[model samples]
Target: MKRIPDEVLDHIVEICNDEAALVVLSCASKRLRSRVACRQEAWRKRFERQFLQSNDSEQKWLHQHMRAKRAATHLGDTTSILLFPQGSAQFDWFDAYCERRAVEYRWRHGKYAAHRLTNTANVRPRGVRLQSILCAFDYSPAGDVAVVSQWLIASPRQSAWFSEPLYWGDMDTEDVVVLSKRQSDEYLVIQAWNMLVDCYSLCVWHTAAPHRPPRTIITDKREIPDVSLRGSWLAHRIAHSADTGQYGAAFVYDLARGACYSDIQGNIHTCCSLNATTDRMRIVCVEYNKSTSSPVTIAYKLWQVAPDRAEPMQCQATGRKAMSLKQGDIKLQRIDDGKFILYSRETDDLDPISAPTISLVEVVDEASGVLLKEKWSLGIRVMDIRSIASHDLFSIQQTYDKWLLLSLIDGSEVRRVHFNCWICSGLYPPDDQWAKMIDDSMWWNPRDDPTLHIHEEASQELSPAAIVYGHDDAITVVDYTGCMHRSEHQQGVERLSIEIRNRRIAERKHLVAEDKRIAAKRKLLLPEGVRMRTEGAHLRDKSKRMREEGEHIFTESMRMRDEDSRVYDKGKRMFTESMQMRDEGRRLCDEGRRILDECEHLTAKLQEIRAQIRALDST
Candidate 1:
């Protein structure tokens, strides 16, 4: 066997589209692996372009054929209705009759006119010929039309077309510009025969202009990275900080400037959300230790953003002043003035009223720590407390005035209730109506047999649990279900679903037995286990039960098989129909061309005869 030349092997690898073949070629030799990896980008681009072109061509042919048939059948002028409210809800809603293209927008109160904004254009011919529609509509911060991008068909034959400029106006000026042929950041549209594949252009139009050329910013194609608007910011867990003793980082993205910053040193664990107050933003981080029973701890940190500066600086720790609180959760709500209300949860101790159960700390400065103004303790029975929302702390006059939702499990029944913090204790008696409501809501009924499980002499009983409310009235029940029941239910469901599936298999086997008799006369091999009828008693009994409940047991399986068969038949028919149509179209086009040629020849002969007659008359 002759060894292939290096150039030939390289060319084969370059043209190879199969991933498996490429993988094998990469392992052929060290030089081949390096060559393939280096040229991966080129191969990827080539494959993507080829795949997109073929896909677009098939899609375009189907669309154009369908549209032509629809247009020929329906004879009427289509109108698009642009509806704008007179005075009530300040918004614009467009209703296109023929194409069913619609969009709604809310108007800025005084900035733009609400009544005189209705505008319509003759889009019937355009819509009929349109193969695709490209739309980009986004409103600016002040409720102004920041951009509107659209592309339409220009002719009935669908041979030529143009794209409209990004319309930027609302109480502002409007602008339009014609697009060029070459692909650029300014304006360039590419059509894959019928469908507009892509439009890579930047049209910057201001709101204060009725007519003007959009400022164009062009860059080389190579310089543009594969950056999409839907792209996500990458996040990875780094090593734990030795200084702050936590595992986390701060993620900040500057949308205006298109830059991202990550602060790993600040010991940030969880970033709830961004606060848009000053240049700086706020993020939450958790600190924990394994030795403590309640090992998990949480804290909030404030970071300042300096646009001129490269990174955000940690200004201060807000939860530090509430030293008694072990930072279970912290919620920050911005209120009047430059102050923020901080709700921090502390460990509950007996004598709930005396012990500091919940703390509403006011953040003054990062250096000074938290200033605790109000403290509340429900009872010594309460073990843990957490703030549901930031507004929960500041809005309530008394700490107990806020509702504390709790979850309780009394050996059998699981109970969840939203009770006033002060009323959670048995000592505080409620009104007759409220008392009945509490009793009805409380767990009085048991689910499973209580006598089934005998408590082990050595094992300690699980403690009662409570629900902690977050800032948004969101409740988090601690250990909602005991480990035993949760595992039991999960296992039961898995077993049940599997048992039903197994029964389905048995029924299918029984059906195969019946099918085998029909095939036996045709001399087909009997599948394994199909002829065996009475071998195992247990298996026979199970199969008997399965046959009785076969309809319900194998409903899902039968449905799936039926769906598969239907899809296969549908695809086969579609392919056959498409091929038949294509053949008919080709034949018709050929016949039409022949007829046209005959007509042309006859017209030429008649014109020659008329010229001869004219010459005879003149003579």
Candidate 2:
């Protein structure tokens, strides 16, 4: 084949619709990969376009799925791309999207449920997963499905069946409801039958079929103990492997039959490896022995599940065995073609073990088994990995990918990752320095808004937390506990008073300079006599107005300063009180020590007296 020109190649790569095409081109030559990879924006645009190109029916199906999943996951705004109103007194505000206008939403807070109503009479309340009450929630790409597991309820009597396996969805136009029905007699019971429930079941509502009651497709309750939905396929442990003494299983589910099947009974972990493509389904399986101290190696088995086929035919394992590494927690990412990337972390040695070193391993097709490639390793420990933007990986700060890691870690450390994609380039407030620069930009007046005030008694103290950029340029400060900072967080508001005062002073100086410049220009423009007369009167009137305005500004500034000072004083007082409390505690400790010493001395004397009494008794 004639070597394609650089420009032509770039164009071809840019327009490539298929991810496989892009990957093949990238692997064709170093120059091609560089050129194609550099065009990230093109890829993003293409991906978005493709995503939106789905037919209305598909779109509706996807949207409904996403909505159902969002409700089932109860992930809140973190996982939701679309912002819906949250009607709780705690979360009443609406943070709008870029293209979408902000609409008023009504929030109804109930003891068991919180509902958010949009301005339109549509009563689609954000559904929450029951597991979100106790455990974390996981959602799929289309947002049509979710899985929640490892739930802990508050009831005194704890039972394994107490774990909730609930799903939420819009039952009708008027009401959004949870699928799992609770029994009236027992609080944490779901159906009187006690079955070992798999928390991660594919609960999808076929909204595509008009007038059809949503059908919940769960794994065959007999085969799989715990099943999780991975894209289109349901991943579950069908049965324990008799050969390896591990859970061997398949990503088996009968869409037509509404059942699950597995050929080889190898120990298969839950929904860790089902990557969904348009036509084919990819299943990843990792084999490990807990008894032996052997490194866990991941293997892949791809299959094409067509609507016509009653059973999904397992295709040959095209990819290589994942990089041979010591067994630890493994996270898989479908890269391209039959290739997969595994993010594995070494288990910590601590009692309540911390996260391990995160390493990325790539598995590609090889002749015999699979070609394993270790891409990179990071120094910092990763507790979790979440893909914030599709195709964009988001993780805490680590050694590798320095700048991106730094931003992510900083944002995550300060609990700000939910607000913005701080790791991505070209976003507002360029970096941490830029964030500080903006903080220096504006001055606030205490009298204008109590929130801006720095008064000791009047102003509340904001907690020592960092600001995270939200959608658009909006910033939200979240505390350590992951809750949004409230007004009371400004309890130490006084510390920032001086900075506010200085900012006001600087602003006033700039205004004064601008006014003087205007006056001087006016003087030069007018005739001599006219200039003299106009200058005197104009200057007097201008001075009067300027003075009045300046006075007003100064008064406002002073009020702000006073408020800031008060806030500062309050913080200082708090610090002082804390110190005093500590000192008092120390003094008491010292007194206690002295009393203990005296007691020791008394005990010694008592011992002598006892000895003397013993001698007298013996005589």
Best by TM-score: 2
Candidate 1, residues 126-235, lDDT tens digits: the string is 43432322222121111111111111233342222222333333322222222221111122221111113222333333322213454433212111111111111211
RMSD of each: 43.2, 30.0
Give each model a TM-score.
0.23, 0.36
Q: What TM-score would candidate 1 get against the native?
A: 0.23
Q: Highest lDDT, which number?
A: 2
lDDT of 2 by residue, 1-619 (tens): 2377767877786666565456666667756655665554565454344333122212322333343334433443343232222322221111111101100000000001111111111122223312211111121111122111111122321211111222334422122212232111001111111132422233443212211233545433333433434334444445464555565465455443465555644544433444444344455555544344334444444544543556555554433332333454455644333333455543333223322244444455566854545555443444445332222234443334422322222223332222222222112211232333323322222222345232233211121111111221111221111122224323244346557768877997999999999889877876786868988999999999999999999999999999999999999999999999999999999999999999999999999999999999999
Off by over 4 Å in 1: 1-247, 254-258, 264-271, 277-280, 286-300, 306-311, 314-357, 364-619
lDDT of 2 at 265: 48
